[model samples]
Target: MDLGVKGKTALITGGSKGIGLQTAIVLAEEGANVVVVARGEDALRGAAEKIKKETGADALAVAGDVTSDEDVRRVVNEAIARFGRLDIVVNNAGTSAAAPFGVVELSAWEQDLDLKLFGAIRFSRAALPYLKENGGAIVNVTASFAKTPGAASLPTSVSRAAGMALTKAMSRDLAKYGIRVNTVCIGLIRSDQIEKSWKQTAPEQSWEQFSRDPKHDIPLGRIGETVEAARVIAFLVSDAASYVTGTSVNIDGGKAPAL
Candidate 1:
């Protein structure tokens, strides 16, 4: 259906690929002006071009690192300058880091927090004034591990938990301004990141073996697609989800245990 987000402008971080890219495409298809932010200029431009070509929507790309406050500020400012206003913000920039606590270095934890937690805070804070002006939405992309931690998932789980708390706190505080804050807790969705993870963690395994239908961990017996997560995020940011806020929606294939 009509998501009712036409003409609305959205800024999405980590939009160069994976779920973020899919989200941008979907939003553009729904007639939203989309600004995709990522660190790599080439990939960001490619994503922007793809969105524009596929959906015939206005799509812009900005190269910036979410871990840097300056970059975050630049992204928000540029988006507003280009679109004149911001109606949605998707803090989707992050990487998955899993290591045994004992073996994990302090630096790793700090970096993880900088990217996953502080990144969202920076973008949300930067976009708050613009969002409040028009009553908009913010969707922070977190992980299911935040709700159910697993062994060796140290920094990621901890950082995602903090992100969930951030979402709740922002939702409560921003509600008065007509701004909604929520999160999409991702599960095992197939993406470039997952491919890299498999290559790094199990180089010996063939792609078929590594990507074989879940038929295991996830109850659905298969991994999820990037577009699957993107659609949920699109709904959360659309007028359709006007009443949804301060909540976490797991985009897993029923893989997440906690309700």
Candidate 2:
């Protein structure tokens, strides 16, 4: 499938590693020019280099904090300056900040909201004008916990739930401009953080053995790969999914409880 995104420009937050990096590579493979954003300049540049090397696609690295409005605007502007047009925005920057409600301080809650919910808000708002001009797509990366919150899933759950709402509302409001907004609710996917947990919790076991352990309860038998989620995100942003908007797709390998 062509995906109909060749030559289009995509800006992805959290593109330094894991799912975000994989998504950038996938988009670039499909012939889309990509702008990779993250706080670490070195990581962002490395990701961009990897994308270009793997896909032979144009890739730009922009280092900035997503939680800052000024940084968000600068990222968008730099992308436009480099690519001359923006066709896709993937709000994929976030961390897994969860703790018991009682233990999670007000500061922690504020920081979580700032990084997850408001970060998306800032980038989306900053990219709106460019997206409007081209009739583009925006894919918000959330979590399955947004739909099925578990015990101890604090600010992350709340913030992700708000992200889903933002997707739906943005879809409705942006439809008239030919801009589509959707979200991917991720489950257990291979990532740097997941890798750290694997190393700490089961250092003796191989990654395959550890991930397939019954304790995780992933119905598909193991944790998902970054490419799995990346493919779905790529589809959502491509012309192949032109009619998909105001919807949430769970990329959890059947682990999420909700429909």
Candidate 3:
């Protein structure tokens, strides 16, 4: 199906790997120019090269920290310089920093909020001008835990909750300008970190076996792939979902209890 994103430009934060990189590939395959942002220069460049080689999309790698306002501004300016316009912004840069409230330090909470919450705010604010020009879309990547918090989940859950709130507020404010804002609350998606855990915890088991161990409690009986989450994000940013905003979609294989 055509997503109607041809010739459009997209900017993805934390696009060097995992869901971010996969999302870039999906958008590029659909004929959109992509700018991937991350702190690691080498990884970002490699991701850009992979997108170009695999999808033949114009991909730019921008190395910068999302927590830094200057870096966020530079990333947006650089994207506009490279693509001349921006149609999609994916605030995907974040880490899973969770722990019990008693064990979590003030520094940890501050850092988590800085990266996940303020990071999205910084990027979205920086890209607002260009997005306003042509009516674009913003997809903020949060986690399912944001909706249904469990024991021992602290900074991540709180920060992601803020992200969801940010999405709703942005959607309401940006709708008049024709700019759509939405979010995807993901769960148990496969990534390098998960792969490492799988190997370390159960090296004797096959990946298929490990992912379906039932210990993870995924209702689908397996971990989700990056492309799975990526496709949902791609659809959200595409013209096909023009009417979707001020909402959050759970890409959690039905694992999130709150829906």
Candidate 4:
């Protein structure tokens, strides 16, 4: 399918690994110039190099923390400066607290929201004008946990739920300007973050236990792959999805039940 976005430019936060990296690769493969942003310089550079090598897409790596306003401004400014215009913004950078919600300190909860919720808020504000001007797209990368809201996921779930709200709000406000706003609620997917999570939760679990069949907590039985999630993200940012806006498309394998 021709996404019809070959010469456009996209800014993908948390683009160093996992779904962000996959999104970068997919967007570049479809002919979009991508600016990859994350905290680790090495990982950001590595992701850029790999995307360029594999997809032959023009990719730039910007290392910065999403929670910091200065860092966010720097990354966004640099992308606009280099690309001269931006067509897509994917709010994918986020992190959770070290401990689960109830057991953690107040600071932990605050930090979690700072990264996932407020981070998206700040980035959206920073990119809004450009999006209005360019008639671009915004894809907020949320999680199904926002819907399930488990006990062990207090901080993360709270912030992610807010992210979903922001998506709907943006869709309404940005519609007149042709800046479509949508979100992808991710279920369990194969990524470095998930591997780290499993290791922390159950170190003894083997690779077999984490297979990609629809056998996991998801009703479909297995977890999703990063690429699987990436495809949905690409679709949302593509011309093929011109009419899709202000919607939270679930990428989970039937794990979430909201209709």
Candidate 5:
């Protein structure tokens, strides 16, 4: 089935790698003009090239930090300048800024909130006009910890919880304009961040072993692939999920405890 997104345009932050890059590829596969935003010029260029080569869709790469208002302005402006319109906005720029509860620095807390919470707010505000005009979609990438926090999940868990609230608030407000707002609460997925964790915490373990070690804790017996999360995101942003809004979907392979 055509996702009914052909000729549409999408902008995904942190789109240089992992789930973000995979989402861009999937959207491109559905014939959407894609603009991928990230801080690394090299990675952004490579991601855009890969999308173009694999799907024959136009892909533009914008290198900028989402935490910066000036950079966010440039990202949105450049995307519209090239694509002529914005149909989807994926706020996926974030990392697990985990710190022990008591020792978590004030700066660290501020940083996490700024990047995960305010970044999504800024993107949504900047893209709201265009999305409203086009009756588009906004999908915020959050974490399952937003609903159920675990030990040492500070900053990230708190900020992601706020992100969930933001999604619901945006959905309520934007629905009048026909702009759908939703969120994908992530579980363990293969990504650069996870690789970094493996190297740091389980240096002696092979990548395969480290990857599987956590599976025993999850019902699926394996970490989710980036594309698996990406596919759910693609659907949420497509006409396929036209009736889906003001909701948060867990793409965790039954890892999250809450419904």
Candidate 6:
């Protein structure tokens, strides 16, 4: 089905790789002109080029860090200057800290929050005016741990909770302008971070065995693909979800026991 977002413009943070990249592809596949933002210039260019080649849709890659206000400005500007308008904004740029709660350092907490929290704040602030004009949609990617807390999920869970609060508050404030805001709380997915962990901890095992085994703690019987998460994000951003806002949708494949 057409997402009814074709010919619209979308700005996605952390669009260089992982779920963010997949979301960009999904949006482009539906005919949206997409501007992807991330810090790695090379990866951003590559991802954008690949999306354009595959979907034949307009795609732009803006290299900038989400932690910097200047960088955030550049991303917003690129979206407007290039696409002429912004209809969808996905705050998907964030880092994680997986250490034990007590072992998580103040520095790590600050760094992660700098990107996850301030990134959303700055991106939304800059995009709000333009979004207001278009009656846009905002989907902030958080983590399932915000609802299902775990001992090993430090900083990420706390930061995600804060993001959820932001989503609800923004939805309330922006609803007047037809700017819908929502959150997609993610769970364990096969992404660069998870791949890195598997590489270091259990290089011998296939991802299928490592992520599916009940002993590995996931109930889905397998690890999630980035595309799986992206499909949900794409739907939320679509006009089909016009009635959805101020809500957090969990795409944890039952790994997280939160209702």
The candidate 1 region of ten consecutive residues with least summed lDDT is 207-216
lDDT of 4 by residue, 135-201 (tens): 8999999987787786677777878899999899889988999999998998778877778767886
Higher-scoring candidate on lDDT, 1 or 3: 3
TM-scores, all models, native as reference? 0.94, 0.98, 0.98, 0.92, 0.95, 0.95
Candidate 5 colliding pairs: none
For candidate 1, the clash count comes to 1
3 against 5, candidate with superior lDDT: 3
Tens digits of per-residue lDDT, candidate 2, 1-259, equal 9999999999999999999999999999988989999999889878988888898886899999999889998989999999899999999999998888999999999999999989999999999999999899999999998998988999899999999999999999999999999999999999888999999999999999998999999999999999999999999999999999999999988989897
List where candidate 6 sits over 4 angstroms from the true fold. none
Candidate 6 worst ten-residue window by lDDT: 212-221
Residue pair clashes in candidate 1: 215-221
lDDT by residue (110-139, candidate 6, tens digit) is 987888988898998999899989799999
Ranking by lDDT: 3, 2, 5, 1, 6, 4
Residue by residue across 100-136, what tens digits does model 3's lDDT show?
8899999999999999999999999999999999999
Give me the runs in candidate 3 sitting further than 4 Å from their true place.
none
Ranking 1 against 6 by lDDT, winner: 1
What TM-score would you give candidate 6 relative to the actual structure?
0.95
Q: What lDDT score belongs to each candidate, Candidate 1 first?
A: 0.91, 0.93, 0.94, 0.86, 0.92, 0.89
Please, what's the RMSD in Å of model 5? 1.6
lDDT for 41 (candidate 4): 90
